[model samples]
Target: MDEAPKALQRFLAPFMEQLTQKNLGNAVELMNEDERNEFDRLLGLATEPVRSFAPYTF
Candidate 1:
């Protein structure tokens, strides 16, 4: 069970790195106008700041 998570993490690490903002920005340059617009909208939703329900600040 413990090894399963570690193995999955190792497999996904490279893909996770490729999904960074810089890489995504570069990829967007290749997209058409409509694709860019849709990607930006989805990225905005994915990256929107989360709201905290706690009273104390981090």
Candidate 2:
């Protein structure tokens, strides 16, 4: 059971990274000040591993 998730995660890792990258790009291009702040707030709670994917900084 544990290995199953690891296997799945390994399989999906590349696609998830690509999608997260694209979404981060789009968020930067489209967000206004208020929206960006909201995004940053939400970002602060994201898991440390992927939070660096955030494309914006205060």
Q: Candidate 2: misplaced stretches above 4 Å? A: 1-21, 48-58
Give lDDT tens digits, candidate 1, residues 1-58: 3344455445334544666564544665566787666555655555667676987766
TM-score of 2: 0.39
Q: What would you estimate as the lDDT of candidate 2?
A: 0.50
Task: Evaluate all candidate structures by whole-model CA lDDT and list the values in order.
Answer: 0.55, 0.50
Report lDDT (Cα) of residue 49, candidate 1: 72
lDDT tens readout by residue for model 2, 1-58: 3244445445344435656465455545565677666555545444234334656754
How high is each candidate's TM-score? 0.46, 0.39
Error of 1 at 14 (Å): 17
